[model samples]
Target: MQIIKLNNGVEMPQLGFGVYQIPLDETEEAVYQAIKTGYRLLDTASVYGNEKETGEGIRRAIKEKLVTREELFITSKLFILQTPEEKATETIQYSLDVMGLEYLDLYLIHQPYGDIYGAWRALVKAQKNGKVRAIGISNFKSAKMIEFVGLNDVKPQINQIEINPWYQRMEDQQLHEKYDVQVEAWAPFAEGRHELFENPILSEIGLKYEKTIGQVVLRWLMQRGIVALAKSVRPERMAENINIFDFELSKEDIEKIAELDMKKSAFFDHDAPEQVEWFMQRMLETEK
Candidate 1:
């Protein structure tokens, strides 16, 4: 697997497995299969309600001698309700206790709403105390990201957001570059929206490479220098997601695929107040 060197000199896999909607019961097996397929990074979140299972999967892989702790890059998120300074610290500890790990490879504030500054301060402390190696925020817009960096001592190392052929987030990517923040794609496939699977341009490119539309999209993101998190419960798809290293997209093919950008999210917009309310409600439900 290829690695992206962070500003702090930490090397993260360009491709990782995400367990966003994976059921707790199935998360272990799915992650174990991903490990066996040579995936060293596992992305989970507090709101996902499966950190325990994710940890169990890692332990199972370790018990079977599949991979060591150092070889794995485990990432988890701090939910919205956990954003107040006190709650943030407590939540970080709780995640560590639940995951049964000494420290995390990456810990992100899951959303832009709520007491994010307070939560970011707590994460900074966690990093200082050796509980988290790298800290970041997911789904943060450029203005908010700049505010956080301006107020914090330790700048965020990454900004995880939606990135795909349909939603390229070019301006956000440029902002990340300005801050030296690494960009990670959450919905790399746009959740199969925008007829991504049947795009004539992508289909033709796939035919030339003998790959699927999803593979073409993923490779395009990687070539553009973004860390991508791909989730799949099926073992075959898991292998397919990581099989992107073999072929290279020609410059012309890359440009043709780039032209497909619609520059907006297919899912909920983080900037919308109602969407923010919905996220808060979901986080509250998960906490309850």
Candidate 2:
């Protein structure tokens, strides 16, 4: 596994397994299988409603002796409702307790809404107290990222945003690099939008390397120096995703794949007003 050291000197796996929308009932087995198949990085979230099950899988892997706790990197998120200093602290403790872990390898504010500054302050405190190894924000675009770095005493060690062939935020990535913030790519495949798996360019590159399009996409992200999170319920696919460590993409191949960029998000726009309002409403509902 490739390891990237964060600004705080915490080393993380370049490729990871994400449990975003996995069903609660299946999360345990899926997580366990992922571990068995050689995945060391695990990503889950408070809103995913599967932290307990995800923890079960991790513990099971340990009990079975497939991998030790020290070898794995586990990550979870602070939900929108938990984005205040008070609630954020409580939420961190809750995630630790529920996930059955001593400390999280990384903890992130799941979204950029709510009391982000307050929540970030809480994360900073958690890092100081040793409850979290690294702290970051997810879905934060360039404008918000700039603001956070300028205002906060401790800048985020990472900024996990959407990155894929279609929505390649290269400019924002450069900004992050300038601030010494590592970039993590979530939804790296664009969630199959525009038939990413079938793209001629990617497929051509894969054919050249005797790999799958999925493999090519992940390799591209790795080449761009972005840590990528990929989720899968099947063990075979889990193995395939991590199989990217071997081959390298040629310079010409990288350029051809770069031409497929649409420079937009495959999902919703995080900067839109309605998107912000909707998240606020969801937070209120969750609070109640």
Candidate 3:
């Protein structure tokens, strides 16, 4: 597994397993399968409602002597509803307690809205206290990201956002480079939307490499120095997602895939007010 060195000197795996929509009951099994498939990075969130089970899977792997904690990279997020400055530490600590872990490899503010500054302050404190190795934000636009960097004492180490062929966010990538922040793609496959499976360009490229369209897309993102989180509940898909290290995309293939970019998300837009309200409602529902 290749590693992306953060500005803070922390090394993160370029590819990781994400459990965004994974059911709580099945998270443990799925996470275990991912670990068994040689995936060392596990991306979960407090909002995912499966941190406990996710940690259990990690513990099970460790107990069986399959892998050590040092070999694993665990990442979780601070839910938007937990944005009150006063609640930040307690919330983060609760995440650590629930996971039964001493420290997190990375912790992120899950959204751009709410008391993000306060939440980031808490993450900064967590880092200083050794509870989190690195801190960052997700779904932040370039303007907001710049604002956060300018205001905060500790700049964000990463910015996780939706990045796939349809929603490349190239401008944000330049901003990330300017700030020395690593970019992590959350919906690296665009959740299989945008008729991604039937795209002729991707199919043609996949045929040449003898890889799936999904694998080609992921490899494209990885080749561009972006960290990709590929989620899969099926065991075979999990193995397929990580088997991308062997093949390299040719320069012509990369250009063809780049031309496929439509520059829009298949899902909700983060900048829209309705989307903000939706995010708030979901966070509130989870808190209740």
Candidate 4:
């Protein structure tokens, strides 16, 4: 696995397994299979309601000798409802306890809502207390990102966002670069939207590298220094996703793929008022 150093001087896997919506019961098996398939980084979040199972999977993998605790880079995010310093700190501990881990490889403020300043402060405190190795945020646009950095003593080390050939996020990438924050792609395949798996251009580029379209997309992100997360419950797909390290896409091929950019997310736009309302409702439900 290739490694990237965070601005805080921590090493992270350039590629990882994300358990975004993986079923709770199946998460353990999927994570176990991922570990057996050579994936060392696992991303989960409190809102997924599967951190316990994710932890169970890691324990199973370790018990079976598939991997060790130290070899794994475990990540989880704080929910939007838990942004206050007290609530955020408690939530972080809850995740750690549920995962049965002493420290997380990384922890992030999951969204750009609620009391983000307090939430970031909580994360920074956790980092100082050694409960987390690195701190960052997700789904934050450029303006919020800049405000976050300006307000905090420790700048965010990573910005996890939607990035794929279809939504290249070139402007956002420039902003992340300007702040020395690493860009980590959430939906690297655009959640298979735009028939990403069947794209002719990507397929043509993959042919040159003897890779699949998914692999080609992942390699493209990695080439541009983005940490890419490719999630799959299927063992075969999990293995296939991580096998991208062996091949390299040429500059011309990458440029060709760049032309496929539509500069938008295939998923929801957090900046939209309706989307914000929906997220607010989610927060309310979580509070209940």
Candidate 5:
């Protein structure tokens, strides 16, 4: 597996298994199978409601001697409600307890809303106390990210956002670079939108290297120095996603893929007021 060194001198797998919407009942088996297939990094979030199951899977892998605890990198996010410093610290502890782990490889603020500065301060304290290895924020745009960095003493080590060939996030990438922040790509396949799996351009590029379009897309992102998280429930697909370590995309192909950039998010726009309202309402409803 290819590893990237974060600003904190911590090494993270370039590719990881994301359990975004994996069902609670199936998370354990899926995570277990992913580990069996050689996936060392597992990504889950507090809102996913399956941290315990994911931890179960990791324990199963360790008990079976498939992999040791030290060999795995586990990540979880702080939900939107867990923003105020008091709640944020409690949430961090809750996630650690639920996951049955002493420390998280990485913990992200999940979203850029509601007391982000307070939550970030909590994360910095956790890092100092050795509860988290690295801290970051997800779904934060350039302006918000810059503000967060300026307001904090310990700049965020990472800024994970929606990135793919369709939404290349070139400007965001440059901004992160300037701040010495690593960029992680979520929805790297655009959730298979725009017929990404069947795109002629990606297909043709895949044919050159005898690989699949999904693999091509992931390889392109990694080649451009972006950490790509590709998720799959099936073990075969899980294995395929990590097979990207062998090949490299050429300068010409890289340029060709760059043309597919739409410069917009395929998902909801966080900048829009209505969307922010929707997120806030959804969080309130979920709590009830």
Candidate 6:
């Protein structure tokens, strides 16, 4: 229910639902359940191969009057394309059609690879024409964000990156602040990487608040002003994730959780060459 204003003055929810690895057949129901559980922000991507189902979920919710289209914040991303510069518009249209929406609340460059400038320009154009509400990028680190923001006419409103107890990017947080770019955290639980859920630090904090470690982590991010994207298929978990607004993490608790910072992703590096090659291969596979 809390809103963070982007650089362009667009408002985004503090906590959101993501559909990264959710199976296609089940995505609609998961999304529908999330909406019913009071999640207004839904994050998906073209590469996730479930936009149609995600859209169907939104449609079912709207039809049942669980929530209206305007009440929800929808987001999807542009994937690595052989020639994104040329195919960007078409790809954006494909997401819109499959998602059964005229415009997206936020559209991001899934990765900083392949014709990014061209894709970003296309997104900027989409924003001007009302195809998307706001535009940004994902997996973009500080250095890339600095150069990208300096060169582009429109600055990125949100830079979603890896942020969790084990791999907290505190230094990157400072850089985003300098540019007035809001940071949205993906994998806030680190996908349970680095044994995040079992950590004594987070566990101790949770015990004091009578909350789960997941709730503690989400509350940490919310206090830091980072929009946290948490994915869950269960209705109870969805409700718990958004129920973080009631309690506040004290300064001492935050500092204790901060000690658990390992300062790097448990997953592979996003800007590394091999990672780039891996995503490029994915692009080929998807296109094929």
Q: What residue pairs clash in candidate 2, if any at all?
A: none
lDDT of 1 by residue, 1-288 (tens): 899999888899999999999988999999999999999989999888899999999989999999999999999999887899999999889888898899999999998878998999899999999999899999988898888888888899999998988888888898889999999998898878988888899999999989998899889888989999999999999988899999999999988987988877889788788987887687677775
Model 6 deviation from the true structure expressed as Cα RMSD, one decimal place:
1.1
Point out the worst 10-residue segment of candidate 6 by lDDT: 80-89
For candidate 6, lDDT tens digit of each residue in 171-197?
899999999989999999999987888
lDDT of 3 at 74: 93
TM-score, each model? 0.97, 0.97, 0.97, 0.98, 0.98, 0.97
Q: Kindly indicate the candidate among 1 and 4 with the higher TM-score.
A: 4
Question: Which of 1 and 5 is the better model by TM-score?
Answer: 5
Clash pairs (backbone) in predicted model 5: none
lDDT digits (tens) for residues 1-288 of candidate 2:
899999989999999999989999999999999999988989999988899999999999999999999999999999887888999999999999999999998999989888999999999999999999999999988889899999999999988888999988889899999999999999988888999988888988899889999999999999999999998898888999999988999999988987998888898898789878887787777665
Worst 10 residues of 3 by lDDT: 279-288
- What clash pairs does model 3 have? none
Candidate 1, which segments miss by more than 4 Å at Cα?
none
Tell how far residue 259 is off in model 1, in angstroms: 1.8
Going through the candidates in the order shown, the clash numbers are: 0, 0, 0, 0, 0, 0
**Segments of candidate 2 deviating more than 4 angstroms:** 285-287
lDDT of each: 0.90, 0.91, 0.90, 0.92, 0.91, 0.90
Give model 2's clash tally.
0
What is the Cα root-mean-square deviation between model 2 and the actual structure? Answer: 1.1
Give the TM-score comparing model 3 with the true structure, all chains together: 0.97
- How far residue 142's Cα lies from its native spot in candidate 3, in Å, is 0.7
